[model samples]
Target chain A: MKAIVHVQLKPGVLDPQGQAIAGALASLGYDEVTGARQGKVIELELSGTDHALARERVEAMCGQLLANMVIEQFSVEILD
Target chain B: MRVAVIVFPGSNCDRDVAEAIAQVTGKPPIMVWHRETTFFDVDLVILPGGFAYGDYLRPGAMAARSSVMRHVLDHAKAGGLVLGICNGFQVLTEIGLLPGALLPNAGMKFICKPVKLKVTRTSTPFTGSFTKGQYLDIPVAHHDGNYFAQKDELSRLEDNEQVVFRYENNPNGSINDIAGLSNVSGNVLGMMPHPERAMVHGKTRGDGYKLFNTLMETIR
Candidate 1:
């Protein structure tokens, strides 16, 4: 099974890269771009047949290595 | 003082920090790799400033998850002295060892220059050498040094007097001009300035050296 995790800064936490990207987009004539928040995407391949087990492993991974629970929030998805 | 400097793959300031500690404390610091699981009986552990893991994904974000950090966190929890500079500070915050995230400069520019910082509250393990309101000129080189925290958390920090240093000039738009902070226990210190780089006589007038000296005096 394959799993994907997207980690992002908590809503109130500042996102400098996202802000910089938003500014660059505006400068390049892309007005109407309201905001941008940068985040990380991780793809993992697991040797599990059960989706629940895969998700549990993914959650453990996030707690251990995949995401920093302090300032980041992560969501995982199982893929075929 | 027996010290250990944690060296991540992309850490560029480890040697400098080690040298500064050696110069002031008369003992060279051990260079520990990021993969190490133990600290090996050290009194002070420094997470020196640098582009750890090339500052990939986020500043100090990747490095915070390194294996060594687990040991570092454990050490801090056990009342060990931990000092995190610039990139080190980012890592500390990323790992939740310290409060506040270092946001980009309000101007969205990489700021590299000497800035004046005032010793706000020195009742901690890190700033006992300086008097309250004393100013030290230290060099800050970072794109993201602006510190942010929730309002209640900020109030809690203020109530506990965990704020150790504040910028004299407010160069980075940090809340309340905060430049450095300590953990609630005061054993963990995370600051954005490069005190090790400012240890030389001519480089920064040695104000930064006082910080190390102060720590040594307390620990010894």
Candidate 2:
């Protein structure tokens, strides 16, 4: 089993890197690009066979280490 | 004062901080590796600046969960003084010992320069020697030093007088120009400035000497 976590800054948080990306896209003549928000993806490999147990463990990981709840939120997806 | 400077694998300022402590207190601090769980006979614990864990995952994230941090948290709970500088400050926030997160600079550039700051709170042991509103010239070198917190929490920090330092020029777009802060209990302080770099009188202004000097005297 594999679990993928998407971590992103919360809505109100300022993301300078994302803004920079948008600026770069505009400079490259991609005028239609309105904005960008940067985040990170973390994939984990699990040995467990149970999907439910894997989801629970991944959620635990997100809360403990994968995401900083103070400024970022995370979503976990399981792949079999 | 019996000080202990915690050295994570990538911590580069541990020796400078230890040297500053020795210069101020006349005793060199014990250099404890990140794996060490015990900090016996230590009154002040310092988390020096550097890219711990190569800033992996996030600045200070991996180091915040190290086996030794559990003991550091215990020490903080027991009213021991903990000073976090630059990357150290990031670790404190990551561990939830201090409120707020340090985001990358608003300009998205690694900033390294000396900036003017004003001592906002002088009641804590960390600032006991300075007059309220005293100005300082401290150097800051970090890529992720912009501080962020929710509006309500920011207000609470201000109301409680936990904000100890404010940048005169708002170097990194930190909310309210916050350069340093103490926890509500006033025992743990996390700041982005590198005071150790400004501790020598002839080579530098030695503006940071008062901070370390006052900390020792007040704690002693």
Candidate 3:
């Protein structure tokens, strides 16, 4: 089984790299972009066969390690 | 003081910190690897700065879950002094040993320079030798040193006097200009500055010697 975890800074948190990207886009004449917030994606390949169990484990992993609960939020999706 | 400097997979400042401790306390600190679960006879524990675990999955996030951190958490709970510098501060926050989180600098730049830090409180083990509100010149180098906390938590930290150091000038957009903080018990401190690095040049009145000297006196 495989699971994909998307981790992102929560709303209202300042995204510095995102702001820098927005500025560079404006410099290149692509001024329509208002903002860009960066995050990360992690794909985990597991040996478990049970989808429900894998999802549960992945959610636990998000709280434990993948996402810093204080600053970032996470969403999980099971791969088909 | 018997100090122990914890070395993660990519910790580069462990030796510098050990040397600083040796210079001040006259005894070298024990360098404990990340795999070791036990630290022997350590009165103070330091998580030195570096790209621990190559800054994977965010700075300090991976190292917070490493094998030895379990022991570190226990040590902090036992009221042992724990100091986290730069990346170590990031790890302390990631592990929930300290409140708030460090993010990329607002300018999106990796800052490496000497900054002024005012000692907010002198009661803590790390700052007891320095006068309250006295400024210290310490070097800070990191990509993610901007500290953030919830509004209410900020007030709580203020009300409880947990803030140990505040930046003389806000360099990285840390909320409330917080440069360093102590836990409620005052045994653990997490800061963005590198006191060890600043120990070399002693011309500035704000140099980091008094901080280490104070800790040595208190522990001994």
* Chain B TM-score against the true chain B, candidate 3: 0.96
Q: lDDT-based ranking, best first?
A: 2, 3, 1
Candidate of highest TM-score:
2
lDDT of 3 by residue, B141-217 (tens): 98898999878888998888999999999899999899999999899999999999877565643367667888888
Q: Give the Å shift of residue B21 in candidate 2.
A: 0.7
Query: On TM-score, who's better, 2 or 3?
Result: 2
Of the true contacts between chains A and B, what fraction does model 1 have? 0.25
After superposition, which runs of candidate 1 have C-alpha atoms over 4 Å from their true positions?
Answer: B201-205
Instruction: Tell how far residue A20 is off in model 1, in angstroms.
Output: 3.4
**Candidate 2 local lDDT, residue A57:** 90
Please, what is the TM-score per model? 0.89, 0.98, 0.96
- Classified by CAPRI criteria, candidate 1 counts as acceptable
Q: Which portions of model 3 miss their true places by more than 4 Å? A: B200-206
TM-score of 2: 0.98
Give the least accurate 10-residue stretch of model 2 chain B, judged by summed lDDT: B200-209
lDDT of each: 0.88, 0.93, 0.89
A18 Cα displacement, candidate 3 (Å): 1.2
Q: Write the per-residue lDDT of candidate 2 for residues B1-220, one digit (tens) a residue.
A: 9999999999999999998999999999999899987656688999999999999999999999999999899999999999999999999999999999999999998999999889999888899889888999889999999999998888988999999999999989999999999998889999999989889767654888879988999888
What DockQ does model 2 achieve? 0.87
Taking the tens digit of each residue's C-alpha lDDT, what string does model 1 give over B94-131?
88889877877877788899999999888887888789
- For model 3, residues A4-64, the per-residue Cα lDDT tens digits are 9999999989998888888899899997998998898999998868889899999999998
